[model samples]
Target chain A: MIVTPWKVSGDVDYNRLIERFGTRPLIRGLLDRLGRHAGHLHLQLRRGIFFSHRDLDWWLDMYEAGQPVGLYTGRGPSGPVHLGHLLPWFFTKYLQDAFGAELYFQMTDDEKFLIHPDLSLDDTVGYTYENALDLIACGLDPEKTHIISDVNNIGHLYKLALRVAKRVTYSTIKAVFGLTDSDNIGIIWFPAIQAVPCFIQSAREGRNVAVLIPAAIDQDPYWRMTRDIAEKLGYYKPAQMHAKFLPGLGRGGKMSASMPETAIFTIDPPEAAAKKVMSAFTGGRPTVREQQELGGDPSICTIYAYYYYLFEEDDAKLAKLERDCRSGAIICGECKARLAEIIKRFLADFQRKREKARDLLDQFLLK
Target chain B: MIVTPWKVSGDVDYNRLIERFGTRPLIRGLLDRLGRHAGHLHLQLRRGIFFSHRDLDWWLDMYEAGQPVGLYTGRGPSGPVHLGHLLPWFFTKYLQDAFGAELYFQMTDDEKFLIHPDLSLDDTVGYTYENALDLIACGLDPEKTHIISDVNNIGHLYKLALRVAKRVTYSTIKAVFGLTDSDNIGIIWFPAIQAVPCFIQSAREGRNVAVLIPAAIDQDPYWRMTRDIAEKLGYYKPAQMHAKFLPGLGRGGKMSASMPETAIFTIDPPEAAAKKVMSAFTGGRPTVREQQELGGDPSICTIYAYYYYLFEEDDAKLAKLERDCRSGAIICGECKARLAEIIKRFLADFQRKREKARDLLDQFLLK
Candidate 1:
C-alpha cells in the first residue's frame, strides 16, 4: 500500500501511489516524446513498469536543448544483489546507451553499515564489490559509468554531502524518514550523502548539468529531499523515473534479499534459481481439478508476473502466456517448469558476464 | 559557568569546570611525571593554563611503555585565527616535541560552513588555508604534523566519520551539544568528523595508539562522546588536556574572531594590536589618581589574564605585575601600553613566520 526507503509491504496500488507521490504518469504521448530522442523506448517503459516520473520531461527538454544531462542510480549493499536490484540498473544502462549520458552508480555501503547494526563496513564493502559485478554484467559501458562506493569515493562525496547536509535540518529528515531521536546520527546524516550524487557532476564540471535518476519507488524519498534543497544549493533538482517493484516469488510483497527463499540473487547458480522458481507461490486453485474448472488468475500469479516483469521480453509471447493462464490452457506445473528454464538460461549467461566483470571492475570504479 | 561544545558563556570557574567535566586537575605530580620526559615544563603547565585533563596519566603510561601516542587539536575556521586559537596549538606543539608524537591539526571548514549558514564553503576553505598558516607559524614540526581540513581531507575522514556516526545517536549529540531538531543535520553529524582525527593515526598505523587532544575546555564534549564509543570501536579512549580560554581584550570569556576589536589576530599589525590593547578592559580604578590611591583587582581583568595566559612567561615578572596592579603601583594606560608592546612583538614574529609557512604548506597538509 505504502512505500518508503526502508519498507515495502502489502500489495501496492501504482496509480494511487502516483497520485500520493505527486508524480506524472508515463502516458503514451510522453513515451512517444522520449522515443523521438531515444530512437526506441526501453521495454520497461513500453510495458509501463516505469510508470511515473517527477521532472523527467524537464530533463528531456534539457537534453533536447543540447545541455548536459547525467544519469544517477545506486544500490545499498547490505547483502547479495538480487534480481530486483538489477531491474532499474538495466533500464539505466538502456538510458545511458540511448542518451549517451554519463552514469554515476553509487554503492551506498556506508548507509548499509549505519542502518544495520550487525553489518560491518567490511561486510558492506564486500557486498559492494559483488553487487558491482552484477551492475557491470548488465552491460553498462565502463567508460560511460562511474561506480562510486560511499566508503571508497568519500573524498568526492563528503564535501558535497556537507553542502547538502548544511541545508537540511534534523526535523526535515525526521519527517521524511519517520526517524526517532534514538536513531543513529549516521542514519540522520546519510540522506545528505545520497543527495550528493545528484549535484556531484555539476560540482566537478563547474557548470549546471541536469541529473536523471532511474530507481524503484522506494528510493523516491531521497530525491524528494534532494529536490527540496537543490535550488538552494545552486544546482538543478534531479529528475526521477520511478519503476514498479518486481514482486517476490512468495505469496505477496516485493522481492527482498532478506527473504532468501522468496528472492533470486544475481549470484545464485542456475540450479539454485530453478529451485527457488519451482517453489514459488502461484495463483492456481487448491486442487488441479478446481483450477481446470475456474482457471488460474494470471494477474495475481507469481509465475506470470515474472514473465511480465523480465523473462518474456517478446510482447506477443507474454500476452499469449497470460491469456493461456487465464483460459486454463496452461497448468501451474507446466508454467512453473517453463519459467524455471528461462530463469536458468538467463542466470547461465549472467554468471558468465559477472565473472568477466571482475577484470573490468577498475574501469568502472571511481577513484 | 558551564561550557559544552555548543555553549560557552559567563565567567567560568576552572576548578568547577574540571569537576563538572569529570576530569582531573593537572597537579604537580603529573607535571613532574611529564617533566621527566619533556626535560622541562612549558609555561602553560608551569602557570596552570593547561589545567585539566582526562586520562592524561593513561596516555603517559602508554608513552612510558614505548608505544606510540598522537596529538590532535583543531580549529573551526569560521574566521581569522586569533590568539585564543593559537594558545592550544602552541601547547599541542609542545606535547608533540616532548613526546615525539604525530600531530593532527584539523581545520574544520565543513563545520564552519554548517554552523554559519551565511558563510559559503569557499569562505570557510579560505579561512582554513589562512589558519593553517597560523598553525604552521606556531612552529609545529611539519615532519610529524599532519594538517587536515574537513572539506579537503574528507576522503580520509568520511569512512571513519561514518563508523563514529553509527555509534552515536541524535539524543546523545543533542544532550552533549544542546542541539534541537531545528539544528542542521550537518551540525549533528560534525562531531563524528571531529572524532575522526582522534583515531586516524591508530587507523593508519595498523595498531592501537594512545591519542591526546589539546584544546580549550569548550571542545571537551566531543571527546566525551569519542571516549564513550572508543572501546566499543576497538580504539583507546583519547586523552584530553583542556586549556583555560584566552580572555578577550574587551572583557571576560574567550577571545573570539567574531568580536574583531577585542581579539588580536596573529595577522594583526602592530598598530591594530596597540589600538585593541589601549581600549581593553583593565583592573585599574576610574582615573589615574584613583588607581594610585586605591588598588586594582587583577583577578577580573582581561589584560592581566592575557599576560598570565601567554605574554608574560617569567614567573617572577608576572607575579610582580600582579602585585603592582593590586598595590596601586600601576595605572591602566601604562599597563595597557606595555601589554600592547609584548603583543605587537609577538605578532611581528608571527606574521613573518606565517609568510614563510606558505612555502611549507604542502609538507603539513594531509591531502
Candidate 2:
C-alpha cells in the first residue's frame, strides 16, 4: 500500500504543497491581475488536515479555460455560525469574486430533524431558512451564489440522491466516516445525501464536471467516498480544496461555532472582543525582562498565532513583531492591544456588509 | 384473555352468526335477493357459501332502495383463471345482470409479485391484463365493470393505501395473516395494499355504497386484516361475501389454478376436460353393489363436491344429489359424466366470449 508523501505527522506538509498542487492557469492569471491592481497578499492555497486528492488537474484545467466551476459549500445549521464556520464561506466568497465562479451554499435542514430527536419537524425546516440570512451576511454574493435548504430543495434533488445512496453500502460508509453502532441510522445515511450535490454540478443537470467542494479536513472522508462511488456511477469526481482546522481561542482542539468564547461572531462588540483577546491564552513568561532573556515560544502563544493568521499584512511588520517579542521589546499586553484594533476594524467592515446583506435577505433566501 | 366463539371453529352457527352480523341491511337483503333470483338460469346469486359481513347493512340498504350497490370480485392473477376461479365471477356476473349494479373486478397483480418470487415483474404486470380479458369473457359487461390491477393502478390509489398501511403494524398483520419471519418483506407490506381498495371501494371514481368483495373463504384472513386496519385508519369497513374453497381433483385440499388437473380452464378442450373429470378422486367402492352396501362419503368425493358448488343450481337438486350419493343410489361414474356435460356446455358460451374478448384486450390493457 503506497501512501502519498505530501503529508507531515498526518497533517499537510505546507512547504511541499505548492509544487504538489500547482496553481491553475486561470487562478494564477487572476492572482497576477490582482497584483497589478491591489498588490499581492501572498498566493496561498490552504490544504486541509486530512489530505486526499483525485482528478485535481481536471478541475484546474476547467478553471484555466475560464469555464464555470461552481463553488459548493454547506453547513448543518445545527447552531449559529461562528469563527470556525466562516472559513469555507470566506474562501468561497473570495473565489467567487476573484474567478467569477458560481457558488452554491446549502443548509442541511432535513438532516437536523433526522439527527436531533427533540427538534420539531416544522421547527427544523424553519431554522434552515432563518440561518440562511447569517451566511449571506458573511459576504456571499447573491448574484454569483444560489442558496439551498435541504428541506425545500431536497424534493428536486432527492431522487438523484436516493439513486446514489442505494448503491453505497453501510459497511463502506462506516469504514470511511468512523461511524459507530450507536449513531442514528439517519447519521449513517448522511454522507450519501451530501455526495449527491457533488455529482450534480454540471450545467446539464445530470451531466459532467462543474463542481468544486471546499470543506474542512475532517470532511474529506465523505468526498473520498463520493469519489469512489462516482467512478462506479459514470459521474465525474468533484474537485476538492481541503483546509486545516482553525484552533479555538483557548488553544484547545478545533474551534467550534457552538461554543461562544472559542469563536468570535461578526456581531461581537469591540469591548467584548478586546476582553476575549486580553484573556486569550499566551505562552510568554510573566515579566518582560524574563521573556527577553528566555526569548518567546511563538508556537504556544495563541495571540501571536492569531496575529499571523488574521493580521500582519507586511513581511517586515511580521518579522519585526517576531524579533520584538523574542527580545521583550514588545509585551503580550501591547501585542493584544494591536490585535484588538485589527479585530475591531475587521468586524466593523463585516458588520456593514452584514447589514447590507440583511436588507437583501429576501433575494438570497428567495422565500 | 377470552377468545370469541367464532375463533374456535371456522364454521359459523347461523343463529349466533345472525345475532352478531346477520341483521346488517346488506346481509339480510343479499340473502333475500339471492332467494328471489333463484329461478334464473343465466343470472342468479349464490347461497350459503358466501358467509361473512362488515358494514353489510349500508350496502343492503342501498340495494333495497334500488341504489347502485355493485358486484365486486377479484382474481389473484398468479396463474390462468380456472374452473374454481369462475365461482366468484359466476355469482358476481349474475348479481350484476340480475340487479343492474355496477361491477368492480380486481386483478391482484402486485400480491402475486409479493407472495411468489417465481413470478417475475413483467409476468406479474402481464397477468393482470391477461386475466382482465378472462373476467370480461365470463359474461361481464365492460361498461358496467371496472377492472383494476394493483401495481398499474397504484398511482390512482397508493396515497390512501400508504396512509391505511401505516395504521396497520407488524403485530396486527402477523396475527390476522399468519405471517412469519420466513415470509418476504414484500408479502408483509402487501396486506395494506390490498386493504386500502376495500375501504375506498370506488377509488372515488364511481358511485357510493357500491363496493362488495366476493372472494374465497381461504382468503378471509386478508379482509379480516383489512377490517382491523380500516377501523384504525377511520375508514369504512367494506362488505364481504366469501365463497367456499373448491376442492382439488386429486387431493382433498382446495383446488388451485396452478395445477392443470385440478383446474379446468376456459381454454380446455372438451376431450381434455372430460379426461380430467374421469380421473378425479372419488369416494365410491370398486363395485356398484359394494357401494350400495357401504354408503359413499360425499365429503371425500371431489366429483360430488364440484356438483354441490357449481352444478347443483337449486337447493332441491343439491339435497337430492347429497341423499342419493350417501345411499349409493347413484354411481360415481354416472355422476362424473353428468358433471362433465354441464361444465362442457357452460364453457361453450365462455369460449365464444373469450375469442371476442381477446380482440378487445388492447382497449382494456391501455392506461
Candidate 3:
C-alpha cells in the first residue's frame, strides 16, 4: 500500500497499516471505556471503521476528569466534497456531540493550491466556501465549531507555523510525507501549517487543552510528526483516532475526488447521484440463472460495503441483506437500486441544508 | 568568499563576486545617466560603493518614462542594527528620495526566529521594533514607507509567499541557499517571505510596478530566485543595486552583529562608539619617526574605510586625507581621533531621531 497525505493507492491492509504507522489497535476494551463516558460508541468505533489510534485513552482520561478536549480535523478544498471526505468528518461530529468538545475545522486551501500546480489560489479558495457548506450540512454544531481558512486566517497561524517549522527538518518531511527535492517548498513547509489547528485552542486560551484528531490513517504521519514537537513548543501531544479509507463505488480502494467516476460528490444532484450509484461496481455474478444455483460473495461487493459502512445503520438489517445476497434472494440490480434510493434521499436532505449553510458560513469562520 | 542570506564569510571579492553572481558592474555610464535625473548621485553610488547591479538601467528607464519604481529592502531583526546592515538601507533611502518612490521596508522577524533556534519569537519581534526605529531614523519619508513585520503582517504576505513557494523546488532551495536536509523547514521556506516586498506594490495596486532593491550582495541569491518567478506571478522582475560589506573594527570581513566587539551598533553610546574607533585595527607603522620617511599604507586601514564608506562624505577632503596618510603627513592617532569624533557626532544626532521615531512607528506599519 502507498499512503502519504497526497496519495493512497493499492489494496490497503488496515492491520498492516496499524503496524507501519505505530498506532495502537482500537480494541474492544478501549471502545467499551469510551462508550461508558460517551453513553454509547459512535458507529465508526462500534464497527471498527476507526481501527487504530494513539494516546486516545489518555485523552479520554482527561475528558473524564472534566478537562475540555478539542477536536481538530481538516479538509484540503481542491474540489467538491466526496463521500470519502465525509467519512471521518461525520465521525468527528459524533465525537463532538458525545464529548461536548469544541471543534477547529481547518480548510487548507493553500495546501491544495500548492500541491496541485494547475489549481490557482482562487480556485481552492472558491472550493473552500463550497466545502464549508458541506461540512455544516454534516450536522456539526455551528456554535462550537470554528472554520479556519489557511490563507484567510494566516496571521493567526503563520507565527506558530514558523515555531513548529523550526523544530522539524527537511529529512523528517522527506521521511514522513515521501516528498523529495523535486517537491515545491510550500509542500515541504505545509506540515507545520497542518499542525497549527491541533494547538489553536491552547494558543488562544493560554493553557494546555487535550486535542483529539479523527482522520484517515494517511493523515496519521502529520500527527506523528506534530507529537514529536508538541512538548518542545510547550503544548500537549495531540491524540488521534485513525479511520480506514472508505472504498470507492468503483472497486476496493480509497474513494478519490480526483476521479469523479469512482466517487459521488455531495454537491451532485440527487438524481445524478442515484445514476452514479446504479453504475457502481459490485461482486461479479455472471448471469442471474447461474447465480440462483451459486452463492455470491458479499465480501467483494462495493454495494454491500455502502450498506455496511454507512446506509444501513441497523445491524440486523445489514446482516439480513448480506445473507439474502449469499442465498441469491437478492440480485445485483435490486441491491444497487436500494442503495441508490437511500443515496438520493441523503443528498436531497444534505443539499438543502448545504444551501442553508451558506447563510451561516460567516458565523462559523475564525477569521 | 561565502555568502548566503544567513551567513557571510571570508574576504568577499567584489569583482569576482560580480562574475560569480552574474550581475552587471555599476560603471560610469550608468552613474552618469542616473545623476542626470537625480541632479546628483548619492555618495555611495559616486564612490562605487554600490558596485554591481541587475536591470538597474531598465528600472531607471521605467522611472524616467513616468512609471513608479518601488524600493524594497529588509532587515532580519535578529539583533541591534549595525553599520554593515545600514550600508544598503542608507542607499535605499537615497533611491526613494531621488526618484520619489514608495518603500516597503520588511522586518523579517519570522526568518530570524526560525533560523536562530535559541531566539524566541518574542525576542525577534522585540528586535523588530528596535530595528524599525533605526530604519525610520535613516531619513526615509514616513508617508511613502510601509514597515512590514513578517509575523504581524503575515495575512498580507503569506498568500504571495505561498505563490512564490509553489514555483520554487527544494532542489532550487538547496542549490541557491546551501541548505541541507538537516536544516529546519522554516529556513527552506523563508526565501519566499524575503521575496514578497519586491512585489508588494504590484500585488496591492492590481498592476505591475517596477521595484528596485538596494542591498549588500549577500542577499542577491534571494532576488535571483525572485526574478526567476516574477513573470510567472505577473509582476515585473525587481531591479537591484548591490553594495560591498563594511569591514569590521578588528579585521577584514563583513562586520557581524553576533560579534559585538567587531561592529558598532546604532544603539551604542556615542562615547563607546568613539572608544571602539580609537582601538580599531589600521595599517601599522612600527615607529612614528620612521613613518615620515616610509609612508603608511592607508589602503589597508579600517579607519580610512569608515571615512570612505560613511563618515567623511566630502570627496575632496577624503582624497586629501588618503593622500596625507600615503605621504606620512597624517599620523594614525590624529586620524583615528578625527574619525572617532565624526562617528560620535553622527550617533548623537541619530539617537535623537531614533527616539522621535518611536511616536511615528504606528503610522509607518503596514498592518
TM-score of chain B of each: 0.97, 0.82, 0.98
On TM-score, the candidate that comes out on top is 3
Tell me how far the alpha carbon of residue A145 in candidate 3 is from the true structure, in angstroms, after superposition: 0.7
Alpha carbon lDDT of residue A278, candidate 3?
93
List candidate 3 stretches off by more than 4 Å.
none
Q: What local lDDT does model 1 show for residue B261?
A: 90
Candidate 2 residue lDDT tens string, B211-259: 6666665555676666665655555566776565566787566666657
- Would you give me the overall lDDT of model 3? 0.90
> TM-scores of all models?
0.97, 0.54, 0.98
Residue-level lDDT of model 1, residues A1-367, one tens digit each, is 6699988888899999888888889888778878877788778998999999999889989998999999999999999888898899989988998899999999999999999989999999999999999999999998888999999889888878988999899999998888999999999999999999999889988999999999998888899999999999899999999999998999989999889999998888899999999999998888888888888998888898899889888899988987777777888999999999999999999999999999999999985
Stretches of candidate 1 off by over 4 Å are none
lDDT of 1 at A264: 93
Kindly indicate the candidate among 2 and 3 with the higher TM-score: 3
True contacts kept of 3: 0.98
Cα error, residue A69 of model 3, in Å, equals 1.2
By lDDT, is 1 or 2 better? 1
lDDT of 1 by residue, B248-336 (tens): 98767778777899998888888888899999988778888888888898998988988888888888999999999999898788888
User: Which pairs of residues collide in model 1?
Assistant: A155-B155
Which 10 successive residues of model 2 chain B have the least lDDT summed?
B1-10
Off by over 4 Å in 2: A1-367, B1-30, B33-46, B62-72, B97-103, B201-210, B231-234, B292-295, B323-329, B362-367
